[model samples]
Target: MRHVKDVTFHLLTHEDAVELLQFERAERAWFEQHIEARPECFYTLQGVAKHIIDCLALNAQRKMHPLIIRQRGVIVGRANLRNIADDHAWVGYRIAQGAGGRGVAQSALKHLLTEARCVYGVTQLEAVVAVDNAASQRVLAKGGFTAQKRLPGYSRVSGAPRDCWIFEYSPALSHGLAANNTLY
Candidate 1:
């Protein structure tokens, strides 16, 4: 685990299944208010283990960076660099309801930015946020992501069709160059 302030990011592992399941179940309803709900099966231990296994498989294939976030050794969130390619990946995360407004998500996003940019050599990072999720929007902005566009009916949030904004992070923005030429 690597630490940023009091938060730590650990690569997802089989041993995390039980704890992660508990975190997910405990925050399921709260999370659904800002993101889509997971299928009922995902709330169980075995189901979580299976989900972890599947993510690990993607991880092994070099297509994802799946990590669990913690603060003082308690599960606070989960984040990832998924759909990874040569120099781009989609970033996503879920923070426990209790951790809201405590800088946890911002720290987690900062760590993910470091991981994606340094460890994975990913220069282009993308995040999709439900338009109504102002907390996450602020986190992304503070982390240097720029609004790209609105994706109409992108997905369901709280079981209702909601538009989303595609936010993007590119090192070029900091370097003041448009060299990243990768099409959005």
Candidate 2:
């Protein structure tokens, strides 16, 4: 694990599976019963663990990557560079409930975007955020992503199809430079 500014983003390993499962358990237990959320967390631990395993496997190929976000040595969030495209990757993130409002997600995202451009050769990145998640939308906006469109029924939030705001970022558009090369 290496620190990104004040936060640490760690490359997950098979040995992290158990700890990740435990983190997911606690996170789910706390967030599942909330007012609004993503449906992916509605599954049983067995299913969730399977999902994490699949993520880990995909990351192993360098086509995708997931990182656990920690602040001050405490697990606080998770983010992923998912659905990689030619010269691009889709990004998503979630901050623990108690960790919200402190700019943790924003800081993590800023660092991740820099790493993506400088280290991963990602020329473009995109994110789809639920319309009502103002905090997340703010994070993406702060990271230089602009709203591309509003897709109707883009995701299942709390078992209902919710509208999503699509955001896209390019190094030229964000940092005024092109991607150099892939870090790996």
Candidate 3:
């Protein structure tokens, strides 16, 4: 298992795709476990699971950089550096339902952000998250990203348009954020 300190980020493969889909199934089962209420972003457990598979398939085929997080060699989450453009790129992530609240997300993110800056010479890194996903918002904040704006109807989740928060960070400004991380 490859690692960044204690957290490991695996390169997604065909086997990884199957594992992610199962993880999605587990995540979906979680949504039903609580009958009191559901999260606002409760759109698609399966679709989102499929979405990750699609992303990994394309990433593998094109050799685009992507990483899947594992703790003690168990799948926990994923993050990708996509949409590359002239020293800038967009980033996105998903933490398995059962894996929330741990520092795994932040650790993987720090590794990615640091790698983008030092190895890829990325000057700007941006991310757009559903406005209601406060957990993600906090992650971006702790990683030194600042909100740029909110885009109305930026994402269509579960057939309804939803607003999203746009956040950006500059490696030139936060040079100390990432260090000694390996690419999966």
Candidate 4:
């Protein structure tokens, strides 16, 4: 694994709107290829501000946790644990196109898992990934999430029905982890 230095994942703040906008705009195309595209309004500063504000409000309510992934002070990605309830939440993450590989997704998943268990007291987490998105699938597996089942035509990617896999993190995965805390 490549050592990624100066990488940090922290709760989002109003001050992050500008950098977040830049990150989103820069990686929009890459992200859209795998996930649904964001609306045009989402590329604007005001839109980004509103997004941050909205997420912050939800965070305050403990309904969700939004985090900004940064590397050396620049926004590189975004991750969120949403729909938090009953000690469970949905995990979602996106890394900038330029920041792909170099273990960013794996690192971010680890950080989010840590926060889910530590800060949010969420014992279980789930993620839905497009069946063909192998990169994300590998990342989730590396983080101890096991595929539970496939949801046929569960999502629309690029306006077409797409199959998806439902993955849930298992505490047992932790027991099987090596001393370094990884399944491998």
Best by TM-score: 4
Identify the runs in model 2 with alpha carbons over 4 angstroms from their true place. Answer: 1-6, 29-49, 175-184
Top of the candidates by lDDT:
4
Off by over 4 Å in 3: 1-6, 28-63, 172-184
| Model 4: how far residue 119 lies from native, Å | 1.0
Total residue pair clashes for candidate 2:
0
How high a TM-score does candidate 1 get? 0.90
Q: For residues 1-184, what per-residue lDDT tens digits would candidate 4 score against the true structure? A: 4578899988999988888888888888788888888888989999999899999999999989999998998889999999998789999999887888888888888888888888888868899999999989988887778889999998777899889999988576555642355432
Window of ten residues with lowest summed lDDT in model 4: 175-184
**Looking at candidate 4, what is the lDDT of residue 49?**
94
lDDT per prediction?
0.84, 0.71, 0.67, 0.85
Give a tens-digit lDDT track for model 1, residues 84-155: 999999999998988878888877777777788777889788999989889899878777788899999898
RMSD of 4: 2.0
TM values, all candidates: 0.90, 0.79, 0.72, 0.92
Cα lDDT tens digits for candidate 3, 47-154? 545655766776655424577888777777777888766688887777777677776667777777766766567768888877877888887877877788999988
Model 3 TM-score, 2 decimals:
0.72
- Candidate 2's TM-score reads 0.79
Candidate 3, number of clashes: 0
Candidate 2 lDDT over residue span 22-90, tens digit each = 676677755543324535553555655677778888887767778888777777888888876568999
